[model samples]
Target: MKLIKWLRNILNYRKFNCRRRALFSLKCCLVCKKPTKRGCNCLNGSIDKGTASLGPCLAIIAVLLILIVSFQYIIQIHPHLVRETSLSTAINVTGVFLWLFVSVLFNHQSCVWISPGYAPKCTDGYSSKYQNVPDEYFKYDPELKNDETVRYCKQCQTEKPWRAHHCRVCNRCILRMDHHCPWIWNCVGFRNQRYFYMFLFYLWVGTFFFIYFGYNRLFELYKVSSCILTFLPTIFCKLEENKIVVMNDNSLSWFNGRRYNDENQWFMFCYYACCGVNAVMLTFLMWNSFLLVNNQTTLESFQNLNAEMRKTRKNKKLRHFKYLYDLGSAQLNIQQVFGSKYYLALLPICYAPIGNGLLFPLRDQVHQIVFADTTNEPPNTKHLKVVTV
Candidate 1:
């Protein structure tokens, strides 16, 4: 009987040991207590280190290649094609390319590093953070108590402000989050939303400039080899004032320099790539332009669509769902994203948007819809009084 009891205890100990070992092998982070990715022990609270992925690296490489190749192409080829090697032309072309390149770089960097403002901890209550905000912004159905005036994020344990949403990827609640872009490897939110749009604008312009300037040389293979500089061993090649000569097929003659044909294929490839990229970017830019003019974020647009669909299904009378933040005027909406100095909105400088991400001035209709007593009947848009608290 003693031996059987001892054997049972030994078996239980082994089973417990096996379970502990299995859990340990999972390699959950000591800080966040979440399983690490491929044995990466992340001490930081967040699960993802955005830059570890391939998307951003490829994006950075693409930008660098475009800049380097465009610089060389314009300097070595454009002046010769125009038959004007003037110092002024060289300086002007270089200056324009540099400005575009710098702007794109700045925007890209800003998008990657800038935090998309996080929601503050709501340990006390809503009043602590939103003390100055107008009461209408927090109004909800009092009788139902279903739609709480303020939203609480369970993951971050913070009060979500008016436009705030919890980003599962970042493991924090973001204020006015537009979206998470893998190419930028960051969330586009209140702080870096301006940079996100500016990056698209600059990249579109850059690709356009590339395609426009390089169109003439696209089909002519001989001109491509001579006119376009390539990444190849050029120690044996002869260099004329406006051309490079490399021996191919035993053709040592300087004029017969189609040897770099294979290498120049990238030039043509880049040309068409830019053409396609420019077209897509134009479409994207235009979409963002429409969003900007209407005071909408990408996430908000989707949410609005969902809300509209739900409203349509429930009550046809409430078919039209107006975005509460839109201040009605297009200029005012535009000013919300870019600062009041509307003229400077075109520039790539990192200007702050009008208000903090927390609170926005509500439209009169918004006040009417919000502050009015909750009822089952459809909202009366016309006669409701706009009250301030």
Candidate 2:
């Protein structure tokens, strides 16, 4: 009886151990926990360290190849374009445009590679750190019954700072996030937003200049046989008043030999394709310009539209909507992107914006009402209350 009991006890212990090991293995994978492309850990909070989709990379490479081919054909058509005064102007314009475009493009790419920063983790007193922030940024949750003024990201298991949201693709919380742009293959957030704007500005200007300068080469190729005059078969055709005649070797060519195809048709096709890309770039450039002027992120712009739609639908009337952060001046808005120095805005180097990414500057008399605290004395001094160490 004792030998049978000992064997049964040993078997039960082994079964328990096996179950524990199986559960541990399940928890190890990111998919088991979150079931998304984003991995367990993200770099610099927002930088996606995981494998990227090949689609965006291939698309970018294709555009570059087309541009190179266009340049090659342009040179082939106009060998003396570098020396000719009119053509030289195109060369100079394209050269400078390409330089600036490449400079900002890589700079923006670096921004994407860099982390947008992570929200503070909730464990080991990290969650308590954000509680000291100003009332305007974080509201006191009365439901907690502890008067703790803080918010948390459930998925990240971390303390979420104001304006911080978790990006599922990257699997981390981004601060002051703009949007996830697959074109750049990264998230556009506070740190990289400046570089992004410069990239767009240069790309728009450069591509437009390219289209204008390269127009002659493409147009000349397409206009090779635009004016046509057909003669009747075995009939003597002539005009009375405006009698003019042009001779062609069509009859002789049929008897002899003929080259049916020419480079003109292919050049025309390439021109149309380039024009199509330029058109898309032009449209996006305008949209980005509108966003910069309005001091809004791509994500915020979409959110604002949705909110306005919902509001209008609910009220059954169209009403003028006001944005909270809009300082009501274009210069101020532009300053947020370009920084205070005028020259820095044009350069590709990194320049920090006026305020920290966390606490953004606001228009006068707006925050006083929005963050009115009953506990704090002296109602007018509420602005001073915003200074949270």
Candidate 3:
């Protein structure tokens, strides 16, 4: 009985800790001094600080349900060839399954790296010791006294680069911090951004493929229904009555009309069906491509626009596409978008965060070489240059 009471007490304590941690982590908006709420415009004077309203969630659920039902219907209605030819049908079906598998795998592996504390000491020549000084150097100009001391990260105790921001969630200072991604469960920092981008690209492609296959199946089902209707007893009865009235080689006339009319109807049905499906798939694919080209996730794009509009005070206008033209010229260019040093170290893909897998390893090697002398020397004006690339 005593042991049971002790176990119950321990469980209650754990539950209290969990609630306390959660409340502590709930961030307050810097502008409002209130707990930050998602999908809310507290910054714009809307004070409904509850969780996300059911409207958007319901809409998303409706779309997913519709897709699921439509896919099931198509599969059941057309167990055979959706494409006109057997080979084309087989290829379409195979492509759909393969793309689905790839999409699921990519989504599962998405993650970002974060440094919880101070960065490791620079072994490589890429980071200059002098660069550790704060931006006060630039702000005060050369005439001002150089009072800015190099600040080492309290956690990692290593010198951080300019513009590096500490990610509270990641518990580390990320170089050129963009944002944290919950899907990957990591900070979208210097590394893994490429994989994230590629993952988005592949997902868009796979969705297009699935839609195409679904469309063809829908078309085939429609054609089959029309064909059955055209060759029905009602049509045959009308033809028989006309033949008897004409009474001059009616059999041959009836046979020729049925054969030619049925063939033409089926051909037209198949052609139109293909056209409709292709158009819908093409439109959706273009939208996904547009998102990728801008290097913004759908969620980020929406949030950034919301923030921008709030600042401008022109909330009436919904000009989301205005930012597209500024894509390549933005501070986060294609090179920085893909060429993060950390990503090169972790992921196998060489597309972005360029260079071999040895980048991080080489960084370590260089750090060891440079810091080998442990003797403490008085701070001086000497500059140490480390070539990273």
User: Relative to the true structure, how large is the alpha-carbon lDDT of every model?
Assistant: 0.61, 0.52, 0.40
Model 3 segments more than 4 A misplaced: 1-85, 96-100, 107-118, 121-158, 216-332, 339-352, 355-388
Displacement of the residue 127 alpha carbon in candidate 1, Å: 13
lDDT of 1 at 265: 59
Write model 2 residue lDDT over 1-389, tens digit each, in one string.
42354355445544444444444444545336553233223222222322233324643664564466445455433443454447677567556755755664566565556555555554343445444444444442211113344656778886655556777655677777777766665677767777766766665565555555555555333333322334421112221122123356566654333221234445444445546666776787788778777777776576456754335322112122344455567777767666668467576566565544545555544444434455653233333322321
For candidate 3, what is the total of clashing residue pairs?
Answer: 17
Q: Candidate 1 on 164-225: residue-level lDDT in tens?
A: 77776556778788877767766888888888888899889988876655654553333323
Q: Model 3 compared with the native: what TM-score?
A: 0.39
Model 2's TM-score against the true structure: 0.61
Clashes of each: 0, 0, 17
Model 1, position 174, has a per-residue lDDT of 81
Cand. 1 TM to true fold? 0.66
Q: lDDT: which is higher, 2 or 3? A: 2
- The true-versus-predicted C-alpha distance at residue 301 of model 1, in Å, is 1.0
Candidate 3 residues 248-296, lDDT tens each? 4766877776754554344334334434544554564465345445544
Can you tell me which runs of candidate 1 are displaced by over 4 Å?
1-52, 55-59, 75-87, 123-149, 220-259, 306-319, 373-389
